[model samples]
Target: MIRTLLALNGALIRGALAFVLTTQEDIEVVAEVERAEDIGTALRTQRPDVAVADVNLFGAGVLSAGGASSGPPPVLVLVDPRRPKVLGDALRARCQRLGFLGSDVAPERVVEAVRRLAHGGSVVDADLVVAALNRDNPLTAREVEVLEIAAEGWPVVEIASKLSLSSGTVRNHLCRIAGKTGARTRIEAVRIARERGWI
Candidate 1:
């Protein structure tokens, strides 16, 4: 049997997905968790054959891009097409056998992805593939840093102090970010960056 673990926030979705998976003769859910930060520990303890996660929120994330450990176990993230930026979090995870499936993926497909992953194969959602191939990242790396800090509502002086830039320079970066993203305001720029998964 393929031991599976779940790390999704939506209770209803998690329950329904669990029910579907339980019906599959070869798959067994070993555990379920709500926090992305808890995924690594859960994996270490449970050591399931495959992990099926939901990352539609796109938060701080489950793994760092290749840091400190031998590597994390295989993780298959479920994403929503309407909010595809969560794919950014998945890419940042840097797990070896990562996979992406649409939130609305059919049960058969979910089973297939899990089985494929359990057997050391990779899976990718079509939308995630497109996002990976087409990113141009209009903002510079520092600009992305500024925008991410700004997204948390940091003021100009605070942002400048944190980055060791003058307040005027911080404002300049915001202005350029707005122009590049075609956003009329700072908040709109942040939203655009999030939609494009740049920050």
Candidate 2:
């Protein structure tokens, strides 16, 4: 049997998925959690073979690129195409035993993904993978830092102060960011980067 842990947010959806998985004689729901914060502990205690969770749960600082070296089990993240940013989040997690499927896929498809992952295979949406491979982030690390601060409504001087850089240097970074993002204004640059999950 494949022991699976469900880490989605809604009780209704979680319960429904649990019911569906329970009907499968070869699968079992070992645990269910609503928040990403609970995933680590659940994984430790339950020691499930596979973990299926929402893509949004893999946000910044929540799951770093190399976090799941051997401590956590394989994870199948449900992605929503409408929120492309979450797709980037999942990619950033870089969990070796990871799988991705559209959130709206039928429950049976999720079952199939779980089985595939349990057996040392991967599951991913071909279109999503293609898009991700084609459109890569071009901004450098320092520029991303400046853009992230600017996104918070900070002024050039304050941003420079925060980063310990001069105002001219900050302005230069913003200019380069705008150019790289193909935006005419800093706000537009931030919006574009944010939409693409670059920062």
Candidate 3:
């Protein structure tokens, strides 16, 4: 049997997921949580083999495991099709499984994603995957590092010092990043870079 934990911010969505999972003979909904804060505890106590998380739960820092104990359960993030960037970044940063589903996805797709994740396979919707790849702007390794430091509110001089690069070199990187992302300023560039998983 596939034991699973469900963590969703919406009550209606939670109900839908529970209803769908219960229909699968091989799947068991061991626990349900309304907030990301409860995810760690639920994972530990329930010991579910798979965790279904909402992409919006990113605000709770659940993906970062901020409040969770060590060795949390493997996670499968369910993303809204309109916001693929947020989910993709979480997947890249944390190495978690991802499955995209809009608020209007049929119950069958949700069930399929759950089953795939329980068996250790990622399940991204075809359209969502295409959108993510097409929307993504490639960034070089140095550009990403510079953007990460800049996003932390470090001044250009400070960032340059930390990275052992000249201020001019850092500024050049920022300009190139801004041009590539169509951003008007360093702050905007950083924001775009982060949204695109460049940092």
Candidate 4:
């Protein structure tokens, strides 16, 4: 059987996934963890063949992309296609052999993806693969850095001081960010950046 551990954030999805995979003849849902903090412990203890998770479970600074002990088992991260479109690459660059599926992917697809991963293979949703290829961050490095800081709800002057720039320059950056993201306001630009995983 393909030993599997679940680190999904949503309880309902976790329960449903357990039910779905348990019924499969070749897969076993070895463990399920709700809190992100518990994932490391669970992985170390359970040592599952595959760890199904959400992108947030693979948080920045928490996961290593390399195949080190600090990293997770070969992961099948379920990403929300509606948000931050290139999460697959974001995860893959950090870890080899990462599997990706859209959050709303069918049950059969989920099973197939898991089976694929267990055998030292990988899977990415076709739509997400295409989207990742076509999707490019339009913001320059400076602009993206500015927007990332802006996501913290900093004021224009504070952001300027933090980034060592003038208040007018910060305002111009915000305006440019807003225009590029088709956002009417700085808040909207931040939201868009967040959703697109740019920040």
Judged by lDDT, which candidate is best?
2
Worst 10 residues of 1 by lDDT: 59-68
Q: Give the deviation of candidate 1 from the true structure as CA RMSD.
A: 4.7
User: Model 3, which residues run further than 4 Å from truth?
Assistant: 58-70, 96-103, 136-199
Evaluation by lDDT, superior candidate among 3 and 4: 4
Write model 3 residue lDDT over 1-199, tens digit each, in one string: 8888888888887988898899889999998899867876776667776677777664353454422244445566766665557656665655444455554578787788778876777776677677677665577889888888988899999999999999999999988888888999888987666555455
lDDT of 2: 0.81
lDDT of 1 at 172: 96
Q: What does the lDDT come to for candidate 3?
A: 0.73
* lDDT of candidate 1 over 128-178, digit per residue (tens): 668666766899999999999999999999999999999999999999999
Clash pairs for candidate 4: 65-94, 65-95
From the highest TM-score down, the ranking of the candidates is 4, 1, 2, 3
The estimated TM-scores of all candidates read: 0.73, 0.67, 0.60, 0.83
Worst 10 residues of 4 by lDDT: 59-68
Pick the TM-score winner. Answer: 4
Model 4, span 118-164: residue lDDT tens: 89887978777766666678888989989888888888888898999
Total clashing residue pairs per candidate? Answer: 0, 0, 0, 2
lDDT of 4 at 130: 68
Tens digits of lDDT, candidate 2, 59-172: 322233222446567788888654466676677665677889878889999999999999999899876676555556899999999999999999999999999999999999
